[model samples]
Target: MPRVTFIEPNGTEHPVEIANGYSVMEGALNNSIRGIDGDCGGNCACGTCHVYVAAEWRERTGRQSEMEHDMLEFAEGVREDSRLCCQIEMSDTLDGLVVHIADSQH
Candidate 1:
């Protein structure tokens, strides 16, 4: 399993192990990590799972898709590193990934 660290707006960190092929959002929801509502059930339709991919891991996480990019327009505190966790699949390369849950997600 790979691990992902979700940092909340209040600076709390929840590190959870996730199975490969699962989305980052699933890892958070399954582990009860706060701040990631995942309102769309891991689908890219909702922006509730918005997070900021750490700068160092951006390339590995890849850029947001067109749908994801468009959907993020509705999210709060959008930024260059902003991405929907639902769109980022967990994998060996993504192990130890770190993301900051958007303040609005809290």
Candidate 2:
């Protein structure tokens, strides 16, 4: 398992241990972390799981796919670091991954 830290807009942090092969969105939802509304159930079709990957962990998270990029275009507060949590799969290499919940999903 890898630990992921999800920071809320209000500066609250919810860190949880996520199993390998699970998406970050699933980790948040399982832990009851707020602000990540994965409406499409971890499908890249929805951008509701939007988050900002911490700069230090961005490289490990890797770049989004073409479909993911297109979906993110509809997300609020799009940024260089913006990514749909559903697209980020957990792995041992990303043990200390940190992501900030966006202010809005739509």
Candidate 3:
């Protein structure tokens, strides 16, 4: 299993232990984590699952899809670290990834 930690804007830490192969959004949803609305249910058609990857983990997470990059352009708080949780697939490489949910989604 992998773990996805959401560092809320208010500085709260919400850690969710996720099973292999599930997206970070699935992890958040299953754990009842707040701040990740996942409005489009991981379809990559919505920006509601937008989050900022921790600077240290960005490289390991790899590149974002064109769709994600384009959708992020419309996100309220897009940043260099912005990523759609639905597009972030879980794997051993992302076992301990930490993502910060933008304040706008809170």
Per-candidate TM equals 0.97, 0.95, 0.94
Specify the highest-TM-score model's number.
1
Q: For model 1, how does the per-residue alpha-carbon lDDT over 12-68 read when each residue is reduced to its tens digit?
A: 888899999999999988999888888989779989899999899999999999999
**C-alpha lDDT values of all predictions:** 0.92, 0.91, 0.87
> Which rank order by lDDT, best down to worst?
1, 2, 3
Each candidate: RMSD: 0.7, 1.3, 1.0
Tens digits of lDDT, candidate 2, 1-106: 8999999888888899999999999999999888888999987998989999978888889999999999998887999999999999999999989899998842
lDDT for position 75 in model 3? 90
Residue by residue across 1-106, what tens digits does model 3's lDDT show? Answer: 7877888899899877888789899898888878888989999988998899878888788789898898888899888889999988889888778898898888
Where is model 2 more than 4 Å wrong at Cα? none
lDDT of 2 at 23: 96
lDDT score of model 1?
0.92
By TM-score, the better pick of 2 and 3 is 2
Whole-model alpha-carbon lDDT for candidate 2: 0.91
Residue 98 CA error for candidate 2 (Å)? Answer: 0.7
